[model samples]
Every structure is written in C-alpha cells, then in structure tokens.
Target chain A: DQQVKQNSPSLSVQEGRISILNCDYTNSMFDYFLWYKKYPAEGPTFLISISSIKDKNEDGRFTVFLNKSAKHLSLHIVPSQPGDSAVYFCAAKRRGIQGAQKLVFGQGTRLTINP
Target chain B: EPEVTQTPSHQVTQMGQEVILRCVPISNHLYFYWYRQILGQKVEFLVSFYNNEISEKSEIFDDQFSVERPDGSNFTLKIRSTKLEDSAMYFCASSGDAYNEQFFGPGTRLTVL
Candidate 1:
C-alpha cells in the first residue's frame, strides 16, 4: 500500500515566483514529515522537515505546512530560482510493525523553475 | 561535513551473479539504512540496521538480500543472485539517533543484466 502520495507528477514555476508542492498520506501514525530534493544521478538531500506537533516550519526560502486533520502537507518555496529545479519527494517516518523507524516516501514531483 | 560514502558509483553484473554494495556511514552515527530507487520511481526502504543487527526490513528484502556490518566503519548489502529487476540505484543513509534526520550517500547504480 502506498501510504504517502504526491498527486502532482510535475510542477512549473517562473523564477522569482512561489512554488508549492503538495503531498498526502494515508497513515495517521506518521508524526514526522520531511521534504527532500534530488538531482539526476545523485542521492536525495534533505531540504526541510516538520513535526506533527507543529503546523508549520520555515527554513529561509523554504516553508513546510502540515495539516494533520486533512492528512496533507505542502512545501512552499519563495522566490524560486532555476537552481530549485529538481525532483522533490515527501517522506514520513512512522513506527513500524516491529517498532523500527520506517520512512514511507511519495512518488515525487518534478519541479521546474523557469528563468 | 561528515557524509555517507558509497563505492563503485556504477556496477554491471550478469544475472544470477552475486553482487556486494559497500557503504561507509559517517563516524559517530549509529543508525544505518539502505534504500533503493528504480528509474522514475520513489525511493523504497530496504533495511535498517542498528547495534550490529537488522532492526527492520521491507518485503522487497527477500531471501536473496542480506546486510552485514563486517567492521566498525563498513556496511555492505549482498544479493545472493542478482535479477534484472534488481537493477536500481541503491543509497546508504546514516543518522545519529532514531528520530534524527538521515544523511544519504551519492548512491551506487547497480545494473543487473
């Protein structure tokens, strides 16, 4: 079962504009959410994260908002730059059946920032 | 600046041959993990290791898959018999604590032909 889902397969935004990527999860047990940025032929790099306890978390140009009631979260990048063009993945960590740290990931959304 | 490192950026092996992927996680980090991503797919967790033992594994980690921490700094994943379906980019990650964020390696592209 896909516990995490990124409905939008791709997104485009003009440079200096705002870009928003959305993600949803089916598992209510997940409490920690994270966003990762990946470039071709490279491993994903952590961008930002938010805990269920907080509704939002901001890191410079990136902000993540979580809505527990809706089981949804979003990442917002302000003043999007061409460098921001990459695949973004949403991940959630939940206690596994064996009480282990298991991260469930979404399919990923390809973000393209036009110059 | 302590990041995870993986060897052999790319590997090509014949089907049914055994292959070993190596990783060296950051020093002082305890929790280690392995994840794989097929082209155009999301990253899937394969296994997590702690205290020199496997803490968790997904269904994808079947009989052909195994992990070992042969020494203090090296972690390895072994595929007893590689299949074409096993071709993917395998990533190694490490975190200092269970709830902490993980750092990932550049990834090793394993192509089973």
Candidate 2:
C-alpha cells in the first residue's frame, strides 16, 4: 500500500508564478517530512523539509507547509523559474529505535514551468 | 558538499546469476541505505546499514539480497539469484544522523533477463 500519496501526477505553471505541489500521507506516525526535486537522469536533490514540531519551514524560494490534522503537506515555490521544472517527490519518515528511519515516498508530481 | 556515488550505472545480467551493485557513500556520513524503483513506479526502501551491519530491511529484501560495508569507503548490495523482476534502478543514500536529510546517488539500473 502507498502510505504517502501525491495525487496530482503532473502540474504546469507559468514562469515567475507560484507553483504548489501537494502530498498526503496515511501514516500518522510519520513525524518528519521532506521534499526532493529530481531532474531527468539525475538523482533526487533535497529541496526542503519540516519536522513534526513545526508547521512551516522555508529555504530560499521554497517553502513547505505541514498540517498534521489533515495529514497533508505542500511545497510552494515563489516566482517559479524554468529550472524549477522537475519531478517533485514528497517523503516522510517515522522514527525507529534501532536503525535509520525508512522513508516512504509519494508517486511524485511532475512540475513543468513554462518559459 | 559530499554526495553518494554508485558504480556500473547500468548492468544486464541473466536470471539466477549473482550480481553486486557497489556504492561509496559520503566519507563522513554514518547512516547508509538502499532503495529501488521499478520502471514507472515509486521508489521503495530496500535496506539500511550502519556500523558495518544491517540495521533494517524490507520484505522485498529477502534471503537473496544482502548488504555489506566491506570496507571504510565501499558499501555493496548483492543479489544471490537475480530474477526478471529485479530489473530496476538501485539507489544508495546516506545521512549524517537519524531524521536528517539523505543524499542520494545517481542510481544503478539493473536489468535481469
């Protein structure tokens, strides 16, 4: 079963506009959430992350907002640039006692920023 | 910034053959992990290793699959008997600590015939 889900498979936005990608999770145990951006043929690059204790985290032009009650989170890119076009994967982790926490990933949303 | 590096960007092997995928995680990172993605599918966790031993593994990582940190720099995943379903991209990742962001390699595409 997909514990983390990104229902929107694709999104298109104009350059210089805002782009919002949403994700939902079924596991309430997940306490840490992150967003990664991947380009064609390249490994995923970390973009932003938020801890359960916080509702929002901002890094440069990217911002992640989390709503624990809704089991949902979103990544917002302001004044989106063409370089922002990539597949965005939302990941979550439930802390474990012994080992590194395993990440549950969404199907990924392909964001296209039109020039 | 340090990044994870994986070898043999692509590999083709016969079913039932043994195959090993190699990765060198960032030098100082302590936690290591392996994840796989089947074509057109979401990425799935395989296993995690630390301090030279496996810390956790998924159901998909069965007896046929094993992970080891053979040395200070190299971490490896070995599939004792490959199957057609084994064709997928294997990624290596590392994190400095638990609950920290992970750095991923470009990925190794394994095609088992």
Best by DockQ: 2
Tens-digit lDDT track of model 1 for B1-113 = 78899998999999999999999999999999999999878899999999989998999999999999999999999999999999999999998888857888999999999
State the lDDT at B28 in candidate 1. 94
In angstroms, the error of model 1 at A53 is 0.6
Candidate 1's C-alpha runs over 4 A off are A95-98
Each candidate structure's TM-score, on Cα atoms with residue i matched to residue i, is: 0.97, 0.98
Q: For chain B alone, what TM-score does every candidate structure achieve against the true structure?
A: 0.99, 0.98
Q: Tens digit of lDDT per residue, candidate 1, span A1-113?
A: 58999999999999999999999999898989999999998888999999889999999999999999999999999989999999999999973334468688999999999
Off by more than 4 A, model 2? none
lDDT, candidate 2, A1-115, per-residue tens: 6899999999999999999999999998899999999887777888999999899999999999999999999999998999999999999997644574888899999999999
